[model samples]
Target: MMRKFFLVVTTWLTVSTLFLGSMVMADTYWIDVREADEFATGHHPEAVNIPYESIGERIGEVTGEKHADIRVYCRSGKRSGVAKATLESLGFTQVINEGGVEDVLSKIAAEK
Candidate 1:
């Protein structure tokens, strides 16, 4: 009986650890809240362009879940700030404003 209980506990712990690790490694989306022209000029390799003006309308199309971590940037801080606000209002809990294109690029480079 004791051996069986120990085996169950060990299995539970291993499964729990794997589940938590996967959650911690969830994808973080990089979004560029710039217009098509600006985005076409240049954007982060991992970023998806969702123009600031259309953020509210395309929220579902851009993000997978409300609680997903999202990093946003634009031509200037202004648009990203707007996008961040819109996302929060729409129930997104982890929207981060990464400022302009250059700023985000530097940040991504630093992370690497």
Candidate 2:
């Protein structure tokens, strides 16, 4: 009986660790780096608006750590590129420039 209990507990811990590890690896953040008016027209369901100019001041709303996986987009690629550079300069490790809003929309659709 003691041997069986220890075996079950070990198995449970292994399974639980695998499940929780996947959850952490799956975390991602989407941001829109356009003006308020432009973002009001359309944006990704998972995206949060924080215009390019304010990224330095408001990026904490997305994440405080420098190792977060963040995806940023805008009306055009220009602003998003600026945001990516700004984030990288701030010590971010994984800031992806997701191009324009339309580009990101098309990319998501293609993935589906």
Candidate 3:
């Protein structure tokens, strides 16, 4: 009986956690345009790694709505600049080249 109660509680907690995580992801995300290996080393928790080259093809996977707000960053902002242009070409009306991760994170925190 104790085992069954523990399983039920664990399952409920898992489901609730997943639901809340999905809710946060669905609302907003900032893209990290660094390569996969580079991104693996370090990145912001909420940042999604989508290399600038692949962004044109893969951005739709993140958001199909062309007008959705999009923020992008990389090591020195160069890659994110390309990403910004690519997103704009793809009809994403609100693309922000947020530069480095630290800079962007601070800006996001400030905004919050």
Candidate 4:
């Protein structure tokens, strides 16, 4: 009986440790790398507008933390790809090109 109880306790501790490790909070930034006109039409609720062309110049205004998980999207995948590259060049650690507006919106909706 004592051996069984020890085994159960050990298993519980291992599972608890794994669960806690997986629960680490990482900040996420959703960005719309589209022009103002396109952004004005529609955008993800959690996304901030920062045009691809202006990314280099206005990156500070968009995100201060270089290590933050930045998710970017645009009208098409082209601009977001550029934005992702630019952010990476600027020392951003986790820049994700989440594709076009529709694709991103669908992804976000599915996550809910």
Candidate 5:
């Protein structure tokens, strides 16, 4: 009985470790273009807040290595679209316009 219990516990631990490792490796990043106040109200998880107007100045800071798949968001699609264009021009290869902050936030929450 003791040997069987030890084997079962070891098997459970190995499977749980694999699942936790996969989850930690699959995180994604998005950019929230809402003003500071709006961002404070609610925003995507760990999203970088760089308002549209100041995006150009903050490009390097946001896209340090230029290798991230960045999704941009704002109050509405208009600002995020513009931000997407600017990001593309700055050589960010993967910029997704998330339309509106509320919409994007809802989608992400539902996915989880």
Candidate 6:
């Protein structure tokens, strides 16, 4: 009984580790939920702005067929938070709320 319990625990641990690791390895994309003008005012080089109000209608177009991890942001962070939840509800593997565009841009600038 002790041996079986140990084996089961080990198996469970291994499977959990692998599952978590794969989740961490998922691809991430920067999705800007700001308006076109805001997005144009210096954004992440690779970010795609679909705007918060338009996200539901444009999610499929922006996301494409391939699964991608998403980092969402807006002018004030509020929209991005909502967008993150929406993306999660829509089945995105990893949707990160990156807060406001200015904050993110500053962080990126600082990193360089």
Most lDDT-accurate candidate: 2
- What TM-score goes with each of the models? 0.80, 0.78, 0.68, 0.73, 0.69, 0.69
Error of 4 at 53 (Å): 0.7
Which RMSD does model 2 reach against the true structure? 3.0
Ranking by TM-score: 1, 2, 4, 5, 6, 3
Clash count for each candidate, listed in order shown = 0, 0, 0, 0, 0, 0
lDDT of 3 by residue, 4-97 (tens): 9999999999999999976755565579999999888777778888999999999977887766678899988999999999989878887888
Better of 3 and 5 by TM-score: 5
Regions of candidate 5 where Cα sits further than 4 Å from its true position = 1-27
Indicate the residue-level lDDT of 3 in model 4. Answer: 100
RMSD of each: 2.8, 3.0, 9.4, 4.9, 7.1, 5.1
- Model 4 regions more than 4 Å off: 1-25
Instruction: Provide the global lDDT of candidate 6 against the true structure.
Output: 0.82
Scored by TM-score, the top model is 1
Error of 3 at 5 (Å): 53
Tens-digit lDDT track of model 2 for 18-85:
99977875778999999999989989889999999999899999788787789999988999999999
Off by over 4 Å in 1: 2-21, 110-112
Residues 15-34, candidate 5: write the lDDT tens digits. Answer: 99999977754545678887
* Residue-wise C-alpha lDDT for candidate 6, range 1-88, written one tens digit per residue: 9999999999999999999978866656788998899888878898888988877778887665335777899988999988887776
The digit string of per-residue lDDT tens for model 1 on 1-112 reads 9999999999999999999977975988888999999999989998888899899898787665887889899978899999999989988999999899998778779999
Worst 10 residues of 5 by lDDT: 60-69
